[model samples]
Target: MRITWIALLCLSLVGCGSEGGKTGAAAEAQPEQTFSWKLVTTWPKNFPGLGLAPEHFAENVARMSNGRLKIKVFGAGQLVPAFEVFDAVSQGTAEMGHGAAYYWQGKIPASAFFTAVPFGLNAQEMNAWLHYGGGLELWRELYEPFNLVPYAGGNTGVQMAGWFNREINSMADIKGLKMRIPGLGGEVFTRAGGMSVQRSGGEIYTSMQTGEIDAAEWVGPYNDLAFGFHQIAKYYYYPGWQEPGPTLELIINKQALESLPDDLQAIVESAARAANQNMLDEYTARNNAALIELVETHGVQVKKLPDDVLAELQRISTMVVDEMAAENPLAKRITDSMRVFAKQSKAYHGISEEAYYKARGQE
Candidate 1:
């Protein structure tokens, strides 16, 4: 009886060990956990430049993660209205959002720094400031209270002033003029004696066609061309003063981001950086072609904004941004950082980029 019992016990132990080994192997090979996220945007679905950037970002994340993660994108009015993007992401209605930060200035006045400052950093300088000059830290700090995190997603370089139906010959011309402008630039326009109308890209064409707005400033050549602003307005102006280098943002819900795995978190961040540079590259390459097409094929009159008008607008921009900064201590910190970085960048570019450009343009 003892011998029989010993053999039976050995058999039982072997069976148990085999099962345990199989379970261990199965656990090691378990399917990688997958995550799905939704992203909402302020631009039209897959529209060029601004609209396409987020799509590009989503694609990169998917490819980099190798099916471990996926993101779905909803354009303006698809998942939510354009203006609601910030709120949707903040409240966790969406996992991610793509838009300019200045759009939410009503909620946090200091939000404008992450987007653009009137006469502030240009595309290159803005990137340097955000990624290298400690601007991103301030940006993240400003957004923390709202339960959101921000990333620099895209840039429009130096945009054109805008499309105008009438000539801005002087400050007299600006008086009583209605223009579709937003953020600090809009405030500057309003203070310059013009009525600034807040309207999205979809609304601008109709407003201009119906004579509701005398002028409108969309993005520069690439986006302006895509919107076909040339069809609605006669004069296309250069040097977008309101948004010298507007940085589109990728705002993510802090909770949703934290829920991602460590590797996924790294993937999301790396993809954003790549997508950000991809957009600037696209604009730098495609904008000139679009501008040529507008001027040559569409008979659009491409003109430089008058020097005096630009100067006056700059003066107002300085004052308006300063006052805005002073209104909040946080904004003061944000603007102080921007001012310091801009000064340092300007000092270097004055000798390098600016000098090169001047030499290239000489008679």
Candidate 2:
């Protein structure tokens, strides 16, 4: 009887072990599930750098995930209007949105810091602030209330001031000028004596061509050239002071994000991070070639804003930023942090980019 009992006990132990092994193996073999998501952007689909970046981001995500995760890309006005993307995502009408954060300032004043600040850090330094300077955490906290999870989607490096039909020799030139500008730049311009009209890419060309807008600023050379702003305007200006480093954002719904599996969630965040880097590189590479084409092949005339105008604008920009900060607590924190980061970056850059350029001039 004792020998029989021992045999039964051993058999039961083996059975338990086998069952546990099977459970482990099944977990390992869990077929990676497939999912489809929708991404909407502020720019028209495939519309140069701004629009094309989202398409590329989606392709990269799908390819990298081995088709386990798929995203359909929609351009501005296709799924929603350009400015409506934030609300669309927050309300769960769409899973994701791609656009500049400043466009959402009406909802969250701190949104401007995620995009850019007048006379602020350029692309490289701004990335450091967002990723390494505790800025991203603050950004997420601010977006949480809106049920949105924001990611750095892309950046247009230092941009051009824009194109003008007439010369802007002094601050007086901007007076009464109807300019197609967007975001915080528009607010600053309004305070500086210009009438700022917020228009989408499709509308800017016609507005300029028909003389409805005397001036307009888009992204730098690559996009400005594609829009054919040169044909309508005689002078193209440089140093987009308003948008030193405009970071495009990927606004994902918080609930939608939470529903994603751990792996899928990681894949989405990683894909956006990769896209942020890729976009800046794309703009840097393409802008060089596009600028050459604009000046040489297209007869586009490039001009630097007069020093007096730039200085005056910068002064007004300081006041505008301060006034906005005073109205919003979150905006105040972000603006203060941004200013600190910018000052540190400028100090370092003064010895590097600034020094290099100065030395190059001597050569």
Candidate 3:
């Protein structure tokens, strides 16, 4: 009887051990969640600089996350229209978007401050303000209401004035002119007696060719050459007072971002920083070569804006910016921050970058 009882006890313990082993195995077998995202951009597919920045960003994220997070980038018109990028990302149709913040000025009046201002910060100064001078914090606050997060994606340093069918020899020449421009610069143009029409980057070439616009300003020589603007317009003007250094943006859906793991979030931010710097470097090198090609091979006439015209435009730009600042409390806050930064930046640049350039030209 005792031997039989001992055997039963041993079998019972064995059965309990088997059950516990099964439960532990099941717990260990739970699968990890992976994320797949769609990023829509405002640039054409594989276009240099602007388009490539987002492409690089997507690649960086994928590589850093080791396939745990994969992002597929779509150019403008692929998943959504260029102008609809902001809305698409906000509504979760896309997890992310790439474009200029000024494009959303109609939705948020303070947004233009994040992109560029008339006679505002250059690329170097702009980057400093954004990264170190509290500009990024302000930008985040402005975008918070839209269910989106903003990051500096790229910068087109000191854009060209524009290609014009008619020469703007004097301030009076601007009157009744129809031009493709946007942001606070567009407002300044309108106040100066020109009609400022909004057109997407892809639409400008056709619009200018078809006589829908008499003048248009894209980025600079590198991008403008790709569109063959020189063929349609006779005079290429310089000193893009409108957009000295316009910063493009990477806007991510807030909910989507919060879903990312902490490590993946850091990867995304670091990648954006890399993409941003890469674009400016690419533009600097490519623009110089493209400018030479435009002047030599294309026989493009590059002219500086007349002093009187520039002076008048500058005056008008001041008025337009001040009026905009007065209209919105947020605008005032942004404008105040920008002005303070610009003043400090200009003072240093005057003696350093500006002076050096002047001396070099004389040599």
Top-TM-score structure, candidate number: 1
TM-score of each: 0.93, 0.92, 0.91
Give per-residue CA lDDT, model 3, range 140-250, as digits (tens).
Answer: 988898899999999989999999999888878899999999998898899899999999888998998999999998899999999899999988999989999899999
Relative to the unseen true structure, what is the C-alpha lDDT of residue 204 in candidate 1, on a scale of 0 to 100? 94
lDDT tens per residue, model 2, 1-363: 366976787576745446554445666686877878889988988998789888988898898788988999999999999989999999999999999888887777768778988888889988999999878988998998999999999998999999998888888989999998877888888888999897877789999899899999989998988888878988889889988898999989998888878888898889899989999998999998999998998888889989988888888888888988898787788788888888898999999999999999998
Ranking by TM-score: 1, 2, 3
- Across 78-155, the per-residue lDDT of candidate 1 in tens digits comes to 999999999999999999999999899888888887888888899999999999999999999999999999999988
| Residue 183's lDDT in candidate 3 | 92
Model 1 weakest lDDT span, ten residues long: 14-23
lDDT over C-alpha atoms for residue 310 of model 2: 86
Q: What range of 10 consecutive residues in model 3 has the weakest lDDT sum?
A: 14-23
As for candidate 3, its clashing pairs are: none
User: Residue 55, candidate 2: how far off, in angstroms?
Assistant: 1.4
User: After aligning candidate 1 to the native by TM-score, how far in Å is the CA of 329 from where it should be?
Assistant: 1.6
Q: After superposition, how far is residue 318 of candidate 1 from its true place, in Å?
A: 1.1
